[model samples]
Target: MITVLVIGIGTGSPDQLTTEAVAALNRTNLFLVPDKGADKHDLATLRRELCETLIDHDRYRFVEVPDPDRGPDAERATDAYRAAVAEWHAERARRYAATIRDQLGSDGTVGFLVLGDPALYDSTIRIAESIRDDGRLDLAIEVIPGISSLSLLAARHKITLNRIGQPVHVTTGRRLPEEYRPELGDVAVMLDGSLQCKQLLPKHGDLTIYWGAQLGLPDEVLISGRLGDVIDEIEAARNAARAQRGWVLDIYLLRP
Candidate 1:
């Protein structure tokens, strides 16, 4: 059986890797790195850097997989989006299965470094499930959790994710309705390419936003203030940072 370790490297920061995650890294026979092309080459570079810095031995080999494009049509309709994502995941499963069969030995261990915790907004788990269900390859999956970007954002901003006994609502930028508000407690937003905070500012003028981009990495940016006060500044800074680095992984928390 091939053992697959879905290890979270934690926001591209080697230091954020837990002891268990490091141990998992050392046991890896192959590390699968996804290449998101030139515009997002920094991500691949960071993964390579982590391997170079953390792995004590040279037994592990790195394999680069070209990520499938989500396609422009995916955004036009809900059904189209689901179909496109499903197709992309299928392609990923095929690639991963082929890699396991060719690059990994019968009992070899393979690792994929996730950005944050494997269970949070990551498709690696889903892809692994697909590969396991196919029955083409014997697989044993292990997950090693790491620090989440939301946790890092909260830490950097010196705030707690939840109130005294309230719950925290986590959602993506696209799924966040314009009328959404944190009536219960705090709200954390991720994968927000549209700067939904700006849209929320008018309705939630009293809300406070603690935002961070590229957390736990050098050149990280953090902005915190009343939504109305820092909306323009965050927008400008986000645009500049994305232009400078060619990519951004940003998350924010909203509290009333």
Candidate 2:
């Protein structure tokens, strides 16, 4: 059986790696890095840097796979979106299975480094399950937790996620409803490439927003203020950074 470690490397920052995560990295015989094409090549570069800095590169092998594209369809229909994502994931599973079979030893451990906690919005855990379900390979899976971008965003802003007795709602940009619910306390939005916060500002002008992009790395950008006050600033900054870096991963918290 091959032991697959789904290790969380923690949002582009090596320092955010926990001791357990470091240990998991050191135990890997192969590291699977997904190359999301030219626009996001820096992501794979970061993974390589992590491996080079944390473990002995000579003792382990690195496998790079081109990430599946989700297509340019703007299909907001529930079934259409589900179908698109499912198809993409299926392709990823095939790639993962091929790499495991071709590169991993029969009894050695392999690793897939995730950006945040695997339980969050990451799809690695789901992909692994799909591979296991296919039953083509003998696989044992282990997950190692690491600092999440959400937690790190709050830390960088020097604020707690929730107020006194308030609750926090975590969601993605696609699922963010058109209506704002004040009762939800605070909302942390992730995987949002659409600048959803800007759209919400017109409706909830009084709300406060804490936004951060490329959190942890040296080129990180942070903006926080009343939604109405800093909406344009955040938009400009996000666009400029994305154009400069060819890609961007940003998150924001909305407080009512």
Candidate 3:
């Protein structure tokens, strides 16, 4: 049987890994870590370090899979985004299939180490789904959850995620409109290529913003204040850090 485990490691921190996640890591005969190319090696390196720290299996084979880059393009007619992602996923599944065949001999356990929670803003589940579509993963597929970026932000800041009777909306920064706000309570924005908060509060601002870059890393940066007060600084700092690191993974929370 082929047991495929999707484990969430959570934000660059070894401590962020839950007990169950660690157990799953040790149980896997194969580990799949995606190389986001040269630009984002830190991400892949972090996953490697986590395994080195928590896993002590002699037969634990590590496979660095290549990610298919979805270039900058609009998804207009023919559902370009869906098609592009499908192609990318199929390529990933092919790689996974080859790895499975070579490593486990068609029946063993493998773990796909995903950053943060696999179910949130992560495409690993999709890739696993692709593997399933190919009828490759006949073994039990287990999802081991871990701390998420939002949880990390809340824990680091010592704040609750939402008001007593309020709802929180988690969304990508790309979908943000010209004006953004916490509809009824709070909003957690991720995958922010553009500073959605800045665009929303261009000039007029009266909201509480909590931001974090590289959330759980050593070079982590956090800023919280009135939106109008720190928007420029946040933009400058975010830009500088992106230049320094070549890329940045960040998320922010807004409450009103």
Q: Cα deviation of 151 in candidate 1 (Å)?
A: 0.7
lDDT of each: 0.87, 0.87, 0.81
Off by over 4 Å in 2: none
lDDT of 2 at 104: 66
TM-score between candidate 3 and the true structure:
0.91
TM per prediction: 0.95, 0.96, 0.91
Per-residue lDDT of model 2, residues 1-256, tens digit only: 8988999988857798998998888999988888888888888988988988888556898888988889854456768888898999899989988888888646788899999888898888888888888886788899998789999999999999999988999987777766457888899998888777666765788999999998998889999999999989998989988998899889999999
| Candidate order, TM-score descending | 2, 1, 3
Backbone clashes in each candidate structure, one number apiece? 0, 0, 0
Q: Model 1: runs farther than 4 Å from truth?
A: none
Clashing pairs in 1: none
lDDT score for residue 154 of model 2:
98
Note each model's CA RMSD in angstroms.
Answer: 1.5, 1.3, 2.2
lDDT digits (tens) for residues 132-229 of candidate 1: 88885788999999899988998999999998989999987876665476674798998888786666665687898899998888889999998899
For model 2, what is the alpha-carbon lDDT of residue 119? 85
